[model samples]
Target chain A: MPIAITDPDDPRIEPYRAVRERDLVGRQHRFIAEGEVVLRVLLKQPRFEIESLLLAENRLDGLSDALEDLPPDVPVYTANRQVMDAIVGFPIHRGILAVARRAPLLPLEEFLTALPEDALVVGLVGLANHDNVGGIFRNAAAFGAQGVLLDHESCDPLYRKAIRVSVGGALVVPFTRAPSAEAMVQALQAASFEIIALSPAGSEILSRVKPARRTALLLGAEGPGLPRELLARSRTVSIPMSGGFDSLNVATTSGIALHHLTSQKDEKPLPR
Target chain B: MPIAITDPDDPRIEPYRAVRERDLVGRQHRFIAEGEVVLRVLLKQPRFEIESLLLAENRLDGLSDALEDLPPDVPVYTANRQVMDAIVGFPIHRGILAVARRAPLLPLEEFLTALPEDALVVGLVGLANHDNVGGIFRNAAAFGAQGVLLDHESCDPLYRKAIRVSVGGALVVPFTRAPSAEAMVQALQAASFEIIALSPAGSEILSRVKPARRTALLLGAEGPGLPRELLARSRTVSIPMSGGFDSLNVATTSGIALHHLTSQKDEKPLPR
Candidate 1:
């Protein structure tokens, strides 16, 4: 049974207070998860420990199946719409929120070493936008990429909005933040991965280039794309665009590249 | 010369007041464009008439080149940071905004009939999420799709957030709303298009199929997907997934599909 929290000011619901404001700071390890879909993903991911759950009373019956998996000690705090709104400092119409803490990151080298020889990977450089990062993770998961590597400048994938945008693919996709963009490239190269950097000024067409046994697709933020030095070091590829429209959203670029690299060589029997 | 306005409540700046709130109710023929990038796109595009522009005082010097072509009668209102914030009822750090009116939609049949013999088109069905709709337009523009056709249930591509997310690709990519999903399909078929519906349960792998000379790629909102009747009428295609993660963002799906369909048949010269 869930615990009824009558007062918005109750200490039990303290973790959820001023959620949008708190997201900017006090993010040592914990993160806020919003809406039913994200909360469900949070509950299923074993590496993240559920700190607490705050739910609008009306949504309790609807989420009973999801709640069944919760550990008994994890407190489920229920409040009316008004009370929950007061706690979160916004109108949370989705009516479900959770607090979860991730375990420390796996070492970049160790994670890369674990990939299979024929693995496909995506490396994100200076991707400050949360939505792009989330979309990349979702694409990576869908295309069955072995993992994603993010440079230090990339936004945290665990941010509430990023997780929601990803449909919680951030939790499922194995990823690590590299020390720097240069470091990420070196690590991939050391792992014998063919590092193909995607850029508008690329020297090779993406579709024409065949993927190596171990391939890594690199992307950067939209305006100031991957650094010149990085592009110079790696095999640069461009998705040939028509109509003189050179830019495609970074996430979309990843999807197209990943699909081409993964689907062409492999013959997975797609259900007819 | 740009007009300098000091008061936030000035009638000249009326079109920019409470922008987010006004977007929902007051959208007649008018739509808002935000940020330097979108505003630049608006200025260059010949279709949408720029009603007025509200810019923070500091950004004026940076936009001289873009403003050079603005019609003399078109008022460019300049305001300080404080006044601009008050006018929009929020902190718009982008510091640039434009109000533009769209010309009446071209008839769907007329637009489809005009596409070239080897045209590639995207048909969006019941795509309620503005971000997804915008993304599809961006992808369509990048891959040189002839045009996008939207069903009645789809969000207006001119919505502020949609326009911003699309990076103004919505304005660049010609699109028209159809009466219904069935009507959109019928129009595509009448245009001699080989209709291909993308679905997770699609009958054939996307990579395996070579597109017909005149092809239309149909996508729906994430959950329900293309209506069952629509799928039955068209050749269904699927992007293969791994790790049991069947879902990909609708926008990413469009990118992958459009890239494959367009890149395969064409031999566009690659720039070194």
Candidate 2:
């Protein structure tokens, strides 16, 4: 049964209050999942623990299918549009939201060791934009990149807007953070991963590069791109562009690179 | 010489007033260009006519190099950040803005006929989001897609947000709107262009499909992809994905598709 939340100030739904402001501040150990698609992904993924759900009363019937499998202890609160809007401090037309606790993160070394011998992953360095982070995760999921490794300077893929832009990819794809870009490269190299850093001045073009059994495509923020040291350390490849124009959005670059790296002619079927 | 304006309500800069509000309504025959990168492209491209420029006084030094070649008759207006923000009804942090006349749009038929014998282009259908439209344009420009064609249901690529997101690709790339998707397809067919529609249910994987001398990679919005009839009418291809995931941000799809379509072993270099 769904509990009715008539009062906007209800303490049971306290965590959902002032969403935009809370987004700027941290979500502590908990994060928000928004919209129908993301809520479905959260419900289906066992790694994330659902704390509760808040939905516009009218959205109840539509989400009944998703709510059927909800654990009894996890509360589902229903509110009228006005109360829901007031609770979140905005008119959230999506009418669906949830709070989920973050899963315990594994150490980078341990996580890399457990990967299949023919693993493919993405390494993000200094990518601060939430949209770009989310978009890369979405691409990573589509192209079947086993995991995503982010340097400390990169923005959180779990950020609310990033998750929303990723269309639930941030939730579906397994990811971890590293202390630094150099640390990430060292870790991947130790794990027998060929780290290919993407840059405009790369020595090789993207299409011609062959992927090793274990390949990690490394990307950095646009404009500044990857640091010179990282480029020199890794096998760098560039996507050929029209003359005098050498920029592609970081997320888009990941998609093109992943598509090529993962589409090897004799590649084995990906494990579900 | 730059004119100093202390007032936000100056009628000479009326076109920039309430920019957010005006973006919702059409900009008549004119469009606003924002940021330094886009402004540079606007200045370098002869197709667009610059009516005037508005900038924050502090940004004047950085833009002096770009403005040196400015035509004497084009007015340059500078104001303090406060007045500039108030005029645009937002914090215009980039501190550069311009109102330019839209270049006359060529008919879809004429535009198709003018392309080179081995032209590579992108065709957008029902893409209503500004960010996606802009991102697609950026990819098109990066991969040397000669032109972009849009159907009637698609949003205007020249919208302010679209132009800003495109990083000025909207200004540099040639595009034209068609009355309908079928009409756009008919025009391309008439011009001897092979139309390849991108869809999840596409018969062939993207990498295997060979491109014709003149190829048009057709893409639709994320959810309700290319219409069934349109899919039936065109040769369809899909980007292979992990079993359960079929979604790729439409713009990312364009980036991957453009990279493959434009890159050919015997392809000639793009004309500047």
Give the candidate number with the greatest DockQ.
Answer: 2
lDDT score of residue B78 within candidate 1 = 96
Per-residue lDDT of A45-130 in model 1, one digit per residue for the tens?
Answer: 88889988889999999999999889989988899999999989999999999888877887889989988767888999999999
Show where candidate 2 strays beyond 4 Å: A265-272, B265-272
TM-score of chain B of 2: 0.96
**Docking level of model 1:** medium
Worst 10 residues of 1 chain B by lDDT: B263-272
**Cand. 1 TM to true fold:** 0.93
Query: Deviation in angstroms for B245 in model 2?
Result: 1.7
| Clashes within 3 Å, all models in order | 0, 0
Position A32, candidate 2: lDDT: 97
lDDT of 2 at A226: 93
DockQ, computed on Cα atoms, for candidate 1: 0.77
Could you report the DockQ of all the candidates, in the order they appear?
0.77, 0.83
